[model samples]
Target: MVDYQIKIENCNSIDCADILIKKGSLNIKYGPNGLGKSTIARAIVSQARNDGSLELLAPFKGRGKAGAGQPKVSGIDGIASALVFDEGYVNQFAFQQDEVVKNSFDIFIKTAEYEKTMLEIEALFAGIKKAFSDNVEIEQTTKDLKELRDAFGKTNADGSIAKSSKLLKAYGSGNKIENIPEVLKPFESFIKSQDPSKWIGWQIKGNEFLKLGDTCPYCSTALPDGPQKDIPLAVAKEYDANAIAHLNTLKAVIERLGKYFSPKGQENLEKITKAKLELTAPEKSFLSGLKTDIEALIAMLEGLRTISFYSLRDVDEIADKIRLLKIDLGMTEKLDSVETRKVTEPINAQLEELIKQVGALKGSINKHKAKIKKAIEENQDSINSFLKSAGYKYSVVIIPEPDSYKMKLLHKDLAGHIDSASKHLSYGEKNAFALVLFMHQVLSDNPDIIVLDDPISSFDKNKKFAILHELFRGKASLRDRTTLMLTHDIEPAIDVIKSKASAFQGASPSATFLSSKGGIVTEVQIKPDEIHTFAKICTEILSAPGDTLIKSIYLRRYFEIMDNVGLAYNLLASLFKKRANPTVQSATESRDMTGSEKSQAVAEIKKHIAEFDYDALVNTVSDDNAMKAKFFATEVGYEKIQLFRIIRGKHEDDVISKFINESYHIENEYVMQLNPHKFEGVPEYVVDECSRLLKTA
Candidate 1:
């Protein structure tokens, strides 16, 4: 397997990081929230997409003009594609409006094998597909149908045109100038020209000039005082420019395409244009019927031209439709354009070819269908079982779509399929489902790298394990692939590496702890033996080589975690408090422990400490000045926090108080805590703040 030492520079909190990832295995990088894990995920995906989005990950302080401090990633040579399961993926692709996951078919069923079969079937019908796309007659006929249909103006349900319809507005109040009024006969030549709309516009513009001066606007001649001055009124009576333009457009369309019209339809069109008043209801009905007929012809042509194995119906039914397609060419030349055979001849040839080879085509298609059906069934069962196993009320059903399949989200407790998955499901539920779907996607896609950026940190313990198993150990999981799971939660490591180690053996999962200091990030590989319970980690720390005060702190926590609040625990607590030992709190007063009790506590403490001395440990811990010096001199972040806690035990300080309130006490007994030295769970800022307080003091 290939090993990657990925280097990232100038990306968010990380100024430079050389992270090692093992190929062909699941790598879990566990760190705190602010260690720039998400930034690493983004940098990897940005480089994979190669879409110039990597520039967005530049550090805010260094984000300026081009090349100022552009984020860079290297050493990921072989990884060309990656799928990231982060909040963005969940919000955008998962829990879509109509399906559980957007493009569910492509993710779940459109396998490379499926595509191979489809390409073979498409190759068999390539001639017809090419004919549909390249035929000039078919192309022109489609354009003609669209042009004719558009002239009718948007029709209503009752076949009556909308009031805003151009046809209705142009012809509802008939303004035909068939017989110009006697008063307007002087300009009859202008109205009778083939391009009368242009002249009507010119006359209308000149009429506006009548309001300005009343001289002939076109000729600049003196106005006649007689009936010639009434010419503007006569022009207005005979023309409306906008209506005339629409009417001219309709007349031109009918003149060019009227040869395809029925004889009765052509006569109706002539009567409608010659009508001196509004068109009769019969004329509108005729236009509506003619529009429907044109749309039907377009549909028939589209069906014939675009035939494929997918669009195949019964052979005879399609043949009859092709044979019955007819158009009236009454009183026109017997042109091939008017005969339906002109469109159907080649299509019929392709159809006959299809009929000859249809058995093989159907067999190939049925094989693919059966394979796809099984995949859908298996995909549905896998997702539904995960939902049920994880105690989710929602289930998924994969339904076949025209081109592919879609997974519908169904809630067992609710009524129908969830229309809005994001709205109906909780944040955890959405993430859970999206993650399972993403696992299948990763398996189907088999990208070079699969990045799950903090995928399961939001889930509780049970759901977290449930999702983890589904993602890495379940059937058709992301096993034996180079996957990076960047998360801030350590429970995943504790579960996958320690508790559920045997279960995830097939996944070949490895884990590491990420820690960032200043601007440089580093990692420590966590072996299965390294992750353990808090009590066990504390015991291990007590036995390892370290400062006595640090060991005492671990011992104190161990006792507390174990509920062993004996004399040794109280004595250590008081020593950290800088109070006299052998003192215990009774009902309301502080009482000294009896000599016998002190002796027994010392014996128990010596069992672990071996060379234990209460006064020596107390003196070491109680010296604030000495502890403050140790805190600065120490390089380890966790050791520094322990030293800071000791130095400010009796002192009232905000930094010390925050550590006490947030992390010091036994808030939860069952919660697993990582070894701070190994995991570096302490934030760098917290250490900085503690050092700041120490320096001021």
Candidate 2:
């Protein structure tokens, strides 16, 4: 794999060394503990996970703590400088020492067994409780249903057939149709033992009455003299007498029968009424209780359904209640096997078995406790063989117990005898043994990386170095995979590097010192060469005084001379005051002019001087020492001469054209020059005007 390097600038106290890390076997970093050497390593790891520059890796004892500030990282593809792990990386290979390791195997076995037992026992208790509750509920429900059904029988209060028969008899012949004789046969037998006379006018109808029913028998009158006989005399006589006697007798018999059966009917009605009344309250009470019970049962069942176990005791109770209700309602035929008390046996049997299994697991755990110690002892030879290749050779045994396991360390010589002193290894030695066990377990499953944090803390220099070497170089160790070792010592790191292992320094002393003072990384590259160049430039610029350049021009009279000769001399004349000259002062007074005329003349003189031929004037004034005095005098005189000539002569166009052409050449020359001197040079405004005049010409 390609090696990756980290570069950080102005991050922390790192005034001296910005880091460069290399990747590969036995990678070493040599730095003091407080420096950001560790920070840099963490930063690389952080950058691998995220974006931007690497930040100072903060040291955290555990996960999620911030370690160092942000560090700038470079060279790693797709990794920016901003990412950092404040906390040291999570140590994937963890080892327990002292008591925890001593009792681990026993604890493991016991905890597992206890958990199994608890689950089974809890399930059994729940089932037993449910069965008890269901049985109670079913018994109560059956009793209530039976009472309610019995009440149903009592509450029927309608009178018997005797009362109905009495009412019919009171209505006399209206109640007696021709078929009454056949209908009354059963009644006749019911009352056969009683006197027929006591039954009064009760009689069977005969055909003899119909045979002689042509006349009204009571009056003994002949039938009406018509084709149809309205009535038969004998039948009418019999019907009339019998109807009166029959009504009287039926009324008497009904009255007698009512007296006899009335008490019994009342007694029976009262029994029914009392039964109904008794049943009504209890039935309602039972139903209300049942509803409440059922609702409670349903709630319980619903709760139980949500639990791990599928069976519910309340459901069984409900089923039993339903069966009882079915029997009470004469619907027992509708009750099925599934709806009865069939499940109790199977559920009880399963619960018993579950309890037995829980007991068995507890026994197994106890048995394993002793066996695990023996097993670990037996396996010690194999473990030592494995550790021997990894540079350490101590027999470590883990014995399972009820609460926790006991860990024992022994040399090969201890053999079959249990050595009490062997269990008392130092903290570091215990840690080593635990580490071996952990590594053995972990290496069984393939892993990509192994991170160790201060694992050799308690060991001496030699031992620490030895362990470090073995961890990194051992045959069983990861060859191609990454192994991150975190430590405060530089010896192991230097040793690794001297052995030609790939190494990067972390935690430089300067890093912490510089980071204490706030520093920032800017975008600008402030190189040593660039700084030197900038300083030299500044010194040269500052060396020359500003006044010297100004004095050079004034002492030489460069501007004054250029003005006297150039046509556009007004440009320079406007800028500088001419020196007061004795000859020129006297010459100015000779002009016969008022104060205003003198001012105008001086202004006109200056204007003409501004337009003087600069190049021609410069060539004429060859002596450098007397140039300023000569140029000023000549410029004033030349302006007077030009003004006088212009006023007197008629050659204005020719003179103006000659001045414009000269000005054009000077202006053109200025444009071609890279850096034209300003005061001694043609002004851009004057040059533009001269160009315009030339173009117009």
Candidate 3:
């Protein structure tokens, strides 16, 4: 439980020595209005906040300093202050009263402007930087891969072993060469066997052809007339035949070498063969071009590989830079896998949740925005309920946007709507709204304590009372931990104090009231009268059969007794009267009143007394002796009636002696044990005499 107390000095009517409040779980101060009650509440709040002693008042201490006069006391360092104030106090301390009834949405807009600006900038930077980093990584990877692929073409096409077979053809058969090594070797041998020096040589000048006629060295043919077609044809045929035979032999040799060579040797031989075939192209133009192309491709591949190394280094550097940036931004602590795991795991989780929230909120905002007009027309009741609770009953719309939220309050009925929050409500209401919004914010964060200034100033008396009552009733729920309410309302304070009497019935709480008189602070104990008044009010309000008439009568009698005898005497007298009086009467009629006229007279007398006509006590009792006899018999029974008769109108001592002699007859069956304490120390006659005096008086 929390222990709340207040002390004041040197402010308003209070000054000098500090008044120590009693250590009650609850304490209340009651006084007439304008006695600086609110002032004390404010002072206590200020002191609790500044001096850091508010922990004594409520849930627990927070981060802040305490005000003056609330010093750090022993054994109470964890106490925090929770003060809820009335509308007037709220207005004076929190916000202007005139703004209370203004639209909550507008107020939120005006206040959230700066906060929105900062958050938006932060979110934007975060989003942009993350996107840029991700894009850079992707782009760098793509560029490096493209460079690698470009350096390595689809296939080797520079007359290498792979391309030679694709270009070769069979000699004289007009068929593609199936065995490239055999064909190439045979053709080389044929070229060597057909020596150009053995044949006649000729030259062509201009359009005329000059040829030596012989061509006879290989075929032994004479030259023909004109172009000598026959002689050249014969020599070409014989030479082709010889070339074919030599090519066949060369093919056999190459095949044998291929079979005999080791795998490594064969690979080298294939490379040499490809190079040789590339050199056999017409004019050697294609071969030379292919060689250049292959060389270029090789050089380009080397350059690309080198560039790939630099690119990898650059990627690593960029990644390192990002890691450092993360640490600088407090996003991560290190580039190690463990650190990455520690940092990214939570962030990823949070990011997922944020995405979910953003999605939901976006959808909701869109839906709500779309139905704004329809909601205003069809869901006015729902809107009104929310508005009333939020302290806005006029024209207002709460619109939640995608990136930001908005609230609009309009006075459409007026000539022009007020766009700003400068209309309607008083200062107290504004403070109350601010307090409500603050509470909402705190609830969103789920804090343990709710510290507030006066939050009820702008309300009317009924509202003030209602709010206080609700707060007190909700003590179990609303005050799960502790609540410190500072107020100047004496009535409510008194109510709380009186309630404490029963609330803490088995264990009473401590209570203290401090008042300033003649510049000195004095602690005034709540008087019994004040306590009774509170008790009376509570009993009337909370007790069963809560009747105003009964309460009024009780109060009237209570005050009357207070002015005369003490309340104790009044209580005792009332108890005696209730116990002594007969609550019910017999309905049976007496046998002596048989005649109609006699019965009627007796009945009339009975009726008047039964009706509580006290005058009838004297009127009906015309004979004093008979009335006394009857009164004595009814009081002490029939046996005591005889004693009363003997004591009537006689000297009290003599009458008492005669009654004792007869009443205490030892032989009398009716007489049982006598009280030794009543008659032992005194003579029998004295005891009897004292009894007779009690009867007569």
Candidate 4:
């Protein structure tokens, strides 16, 4: 810790913060979310930045505090510089769309000048050899295999099939029907037996053959005289009833099923068949399986069409076949799934060959270490080694190249393509990357003072632990720099404060509380936390003097483990009470007396808010009406229902979003200004009274 004394007057939140931060001491400052823990940390950095040498942010001079002409910020003398990781730093380096930070580079003698004499270049290489004697093997390969895989065309199928090519050019091409249905088989047999001419109806002659009266119309020829004589042309109609009726029915069914065999429908079937073949293994199997039913339906239609008119067979199958086809068609997807297949082999083979060639080059060329070009090709070896040692799950390395160095994050995706560090990294991974570089720069520089404002804001639990261990576990890394870590998170804050030691030079830590109200900051004293068991250290620090804003948050953390929300809310209500007027205070106390526990609580909160009586906010949509619309029906529908929306309280939400829209507000927004810690020459009583008011919460 770079020992520095601090005194603030009319700063962002600190009305006056006079404290001596000893050197090499683990000093921690914590508060509740939205209460500007970052403010105090940045204020310290701003003081260090004021020495006129560092191009840094100016200290905060309380803009809202009245009678604040100029701030009297002091006690920052030998502070050379400050390494701060605040919002500004995160915005500039962590999440912008820019080239990812260099993590690795190479060793080579590459000249920047476009043109040079052969002898001049030879002299340069000779000079490199003279300076560096150790041979270093630098492998040139693709940086990110995963990204390269994406760069390869998305299309995979060969598209070389003759049918696909021909069908696309002409829609009608290759259009054909499937197998004729079994239902048509009997009709085909009946059609072959047709001998309608042999029927007695053929012999019938004369108008109606006497309306087919008692006599056999064919034998009417026996009556040679009158109308019946001389073999009257009017013969009998023998088979007309059964054979003609069946034939007509067959014809009707055939017409109904004919659409599948039509030119248009046949063209579509052909497309389906071609698509089936083009699909990936699974999709091809699925489409092929559907062909059985399709073929059976077509066969049924064909059988119906070929039915004989003279003889009858079962045409009962037509309707059933048509129904089956309709059912199948309805179930079929509008678009068939023809997944992709690799048209070409993976590029791994080529990459492997290139790697081999590089190996060969090493044998031919003399192995020698060269002056690494920091300007042109940055050396990320330091960072890469640190990250790898820290258990990063990638074969990260840096290699020298012609103009710039290659940062190979050597890990392939399922498709065997290496992943890009920049192009498509996840949010968590990006956070880790940015933080690693930030720490590397800070520790490598060995700055006198380090101010990290919620550095692990985007980190996971495991990552948070890893960083904490690295910073506080040993004295070797931070032996020279004074570290002041600021966080609203209780766990980490506990860790830093518990590690407090006079071996401040060693592995010990100290802490302070920065409570704020209406954007004015004040440091309060409860008790230096009693030395307690490691398990109880968090509770101890939380007990230290600070605003109820922080204490309420700490209580919430306790409730998470304790599972006593009622107690947590009661405490939270107390914190709100600190800022609430008498009416609002009375409202918070009106919890459920009998049946109206949660409902009463909500009404009281809403009622207190309504007292503000902002017409615009009141006219806004009603949370009650919205609650009824979204969830009331659900409650009635279920057998059991929860009485309270236990998660609906203002701060219960994990995602820190939105202002609570209450007259009593907690200040989360922060501002930075220069010339912090300005001590004003006010009477002791006035300044003392003001300080009491600031810490009263």
Candidate 5:
């Protein structure tokens, strides 16, 4: 069937879409990337593998209810198989040439780019395959961490972490000093009315005054060396012994609390920081905040110590400060503590998963690279033949090195021994290699349909022309087969239309463009390029208001192909003369004829169009006259053509009208001017007339 309609729903970038390919062979669909071009290509291949498996038809990525999201491919009949060549197919067969790493930074940048893609792939997998829920868990954990960090506190206005002070006394009272209690007892009565808290403070002041000797507040000693000779030697040992005993007791309590405040308590935070894990913004800030608090708490504990003599107030202050610190340090699980293993254990588990998944992604890519090398080795001869035919000079030869697997591109030398293809081939050359691989396995094997997406990526103009010629010219040109090609490059597409201009001399090239509007793939009408048959030419000529020159050229050429140029010309010229003015063919004629010209005019027209008296070419027994008569002929040569007319009747006015209009418009335009560069080229009247003629023919 020349016409095939495929309905694509939720397929990759396409939402719910339908594209009608009128004449399927050598069709080229044009669109931008992410516009469902590749989606449609893969869908065709998937359907070929299993028409009934809707799972294959499912879009590679999209959002919807699971099964409901599966794309539906309908109305494909006799499309036995559609093989596809795309970036994905290329990656399966080719590799970059080994090169020296002159710059380490470049490798780092590429690795980062690769990592990003790997993450994206994992996320996609998480969505498609339920078993790959690792990313899902990471995402959820990250989200939870975000909420927690926001609840903790707003960050300092700057992005940098607020540096916590190392000074222990930055908070609470740390003014009390270790001193002898007996030295202060002598002054106890001097401040007897003072409360115990006040008395302890006054007594400490009294001892400092005594250390001054004559100038000290109590003894009023002026000499600095005077107090050294009379220092209380006997009592010092007793105080020293008491201080050591008290130190042991307090140290034990301090040790008990250190487990919760020390770096040991912040194991998860340390691990996350050391891993330099690339978590979300909130997660990073949250961990940083926790680490800062741990450091501040450790600094506070450094100031706590016991003395030989302890005042009641100092002891209470120490106890009260420690309790408050425990709170600040997140030691109490009021709701949930940040440093607690329970809070961070799941996150740590998720972090481990990130590592595993990232590695898995890298492994998967490497595995594909290796597999391509193996596939090339296995299919060398066939692939090389396909390449040479497609205009490449090289043959693929895999050189097995124990250290690494690599493929060498080889070409024949004068002496007949194959040598390396070249020092380096451009990116386009490698892409050509990929196309050759595809052509060998798919197009050369006679698949009913071949869908190539962006087939000439990175291709220069010369390469583009070579590819179009290699694929579309001579016997290699797709004939009696439906080839669907899509590209984002408009220039190449225009060239392709121009290159195939001759083979479809009297027939329209089955080329159309697809545009995505609101995620739907809609066919944009291609004019003049598709106008290719006898009826189309007559309609366009009859309908034109200004210029019918191109259509006239088309009419002559089409009749020539049917071997009826002179005979059909004679009849049409007479009909127009008999009616005076040519009218658009219709059930109700567009207008009544007014006699305009005669046979002299028809003969003059023949002189303008005859191009060496084509009538001479049409005078054989079953000549142009007989062929022209066969349009109304009931027998053999015309049955298939007549059936197309009957099928035209079965469709709605819109479909039939579109088909013929494009056919006539494209064919006529190509004949006169290969480039359809301007608007107002063909009038509306011609459009309707062409539809009318095709319907009748």
Candidate 6:
């Protein structure tokens, strides 16, 4: 394995972080909550994709400055591509409608082998594609097909015409223009001209003014006769300008494309346009049937021109489809244009070529079908199994598409498939499912590096370990890849590197504690031996050099853990409440701790701290001035918390008192807390709250 040092500078909270990551290993960066782990994940991803968003990571102190500090990531040249599972990735890709993940087909199916087989099949169909391209008539043939298809409306069926049909709007029962009336025969030349729709519109506009009076509304001439009144009624009886314009457009299209139609089709169309009245029912049926024929021809031609592996999935079916492209020879015979013969001749030849090649195409596709099928089934089963084991009632099924596959999410209580997974899934469920899917995606892509930034910290211990095992400890998992898992919770590191190390044999897991100070981040290797129980940690600290009050705090915790809460625990707790040699008062009697009780507690405390003196520890915590001085002088967050606890003894402020109580008792039996070796384990905000409360006092 090669070790690479990744140096990041001036990015977010990290000023400089020189981290060593080993290729082909699972490297975990473990730290407390605010050590810039997510920022590092984003920075590395930004550089790997070369998306130019790395400048957005410049630290807030250096923002809006010209050339002040440029965020840079070095030593990642070997990482050509990386898949990171972060909060942003989860929100963007997981819990999509109709599927658990947005491009599930690419992650679960389409391997390098599948793509290669598809390319071979495409090459086999190249002959048919080239024939269509070489013939220059194919473009016009498509246009001719579209022109006839538009004349019959959407369904191309024998029924009442749709209101939106171009043919219906132009030449329906009341829409068409018939012969001119005898009253307007004087202007027959203008009415029968090449363009009469505009002139008809002008005449109709002039007729509207005749309603004003018996006199002429336009030129102020007298019109008291009956014949002039009949002029307005005749003008209003004609078709509107839009209907006339549509009729003109239809006639022009038919004139250019009619030669391609059969004799019966051309005759029926001419009679419809030339008739002086509405068409008969038989005539409408003829046009609808003709429309169906034209639509089928267009579909056949277009389908054959672009054959691929998806088209030839079933050999017999595609062979039938290709043979159907051969139209009747009589249709071509009526056309005088050379383009018709050019198109029909090559189509017949390619029909033969396509029918002959179907067997070979089927063989090529079948060669890879087993592998692709297995991949799809395994992916579906893997995700569903994860959901089951992790207490999620949802499952995924990979449905096949024409050229790919789709993975749809299903719920046990819901009907059919869920179309909106994001709505049904909780926030944690979404995050968990996204993490597992991301692991599968990393396996599919086989990128150089995989980064999981604080992925499983949101889960409980049971689910956290379940997800970790699924991600790094299976046959088809990210076991030996170069993976970086950054987390604030120590559970993953404890489980992967220590508790369950044998479970993940090939993972090559290792961890480092990340800590930041003054915008500079650093890491220290956390050996398995360094992770200890809280009781052992308390003992280790009590044995070292430190303040007496801090040692008493650890002693109190040890007594609580050891169940020795009778004399020693209560006495130390009383001292913590700012009382020295405390008294116990109940409904019965009030009494001070006698010399014998003090000696007994002192003796028990000295077992852990050899120099422990009861009076000295009590006196150290009782003096508020000395404890406040220690709180200001100390930089360690845990120490600050303890000193604040001593300084704010029995104060009536419930908020600060509650915070101190929780912080004091947070280290329980099950928690795997890191030793604060030169770094603060508690958050700065907790210590700041303590400092703020004390300063007011």
Better of 1 and 4 by TM-score: 1
**Total clashing pairs in model 3:** 31
RMSD of 2: 34.9
Query: Residue-wise lDDT of candidate 5 within 299-330, one digit each (tens)?
Result: 33222211111111123233343233222334
Please list all clashing residue pairs in model 1, or write none if there are none: none
lDDT of 2 by residue, 221-331 (tens): 565665334333223333333333433453343333222222433343233222312223333333233333333433333333233222221232332322221111112
Model 1: how far residue 387 lies from native, Å: 2.1
Task: Kindly list the per-residue Cα lDDT of model 6 for residues 170-228, writing each as its tens digit.
Answer: 77653334466677776677666677688778877888778778877656888868666
Best candidate, TM-score = 6
User: Candidates' TM-scores?
Assistant: 0.84, 0.27, 0.30, 0.37, 0.32, 0.88
lDDT at position 276, candidate 6:
65
- Residues 1-697, model 3: lDDT tens digits: 4443334544544444343332323344433233445555555554544665433433122225454443222222243443443554334433322222233333333234334543443352343234334443323333432332232233355533222221221122221122223323333333344442122122111112214544443344564565444433433433333333433443344344343233443454344333423334342333233334334433432332222111222232332322222212122111113422342344334334434344343443344434443433333333333335444545444554433334444444565333435346455544544444343333233333333333444465555544444333322123332333333333344344454334333223233344433445444555333443422442343333422222222332333333423322222222222322212112342222124533343343333222322223323233446444544443222223233333343434565446444432223211112112111212223334444554566
Task: List model 4 lDDT by residue over 1-697, tens digit each.
Answer: 3466677554444455565566766566654455545556656666676654211222355345665544445677777678876656655654333234432221112233212322332332342232222222101011121121122213225422222222222211211112212333323333234443233234333436645554545445434446434223322211232333333333333334333233544444444433412334443333233333334433432322222211111223332332332222323332122210010012222223333343332322222222333422332544444445556654444544443444455543333324445555666566666665566556545677778777775665567656665555532245445777776554554444443333233545665555554445554421235323322432543545532323333343344334444632443443333312112223356442233443444343333232222222222213434333333332211100110121133332222113222101223312111011121111222223323332342
lDDT for each candidate structure: 0.76, 0.36, 0.36, 0.39, 0.45, 0.76
Q: What lDDT, from 0 to 1, does candidate 2 have?
A: 0.36
Given candidate 3, what's the lDDT at residue 488? 35
Report residue 90 deviation for candidate 5 (angstroms).
2.1
| Model 6 TM-score relative to the real fold | 0.88
Candidate of highest lDDT: 1
Those runs of model 4 whose alpha carbons end farther than 4 Å from true positions after fitting are 51-67, 94-392, 403-407, 412-420, 474-476, 497-507, 517-520, 524-697
Local lDDT at 414 for model 2:
61
Better of 3 and 5 by lDDT: 5
- For each predicted model, how many residue pairs clash, with residues at least 3 apart or on different chains? 0, 58, 31, 55, 17, 0
Better of 1 and 2 by TM-score: 1
Pick the winner on lDDT between candidates 3 and 4. 4
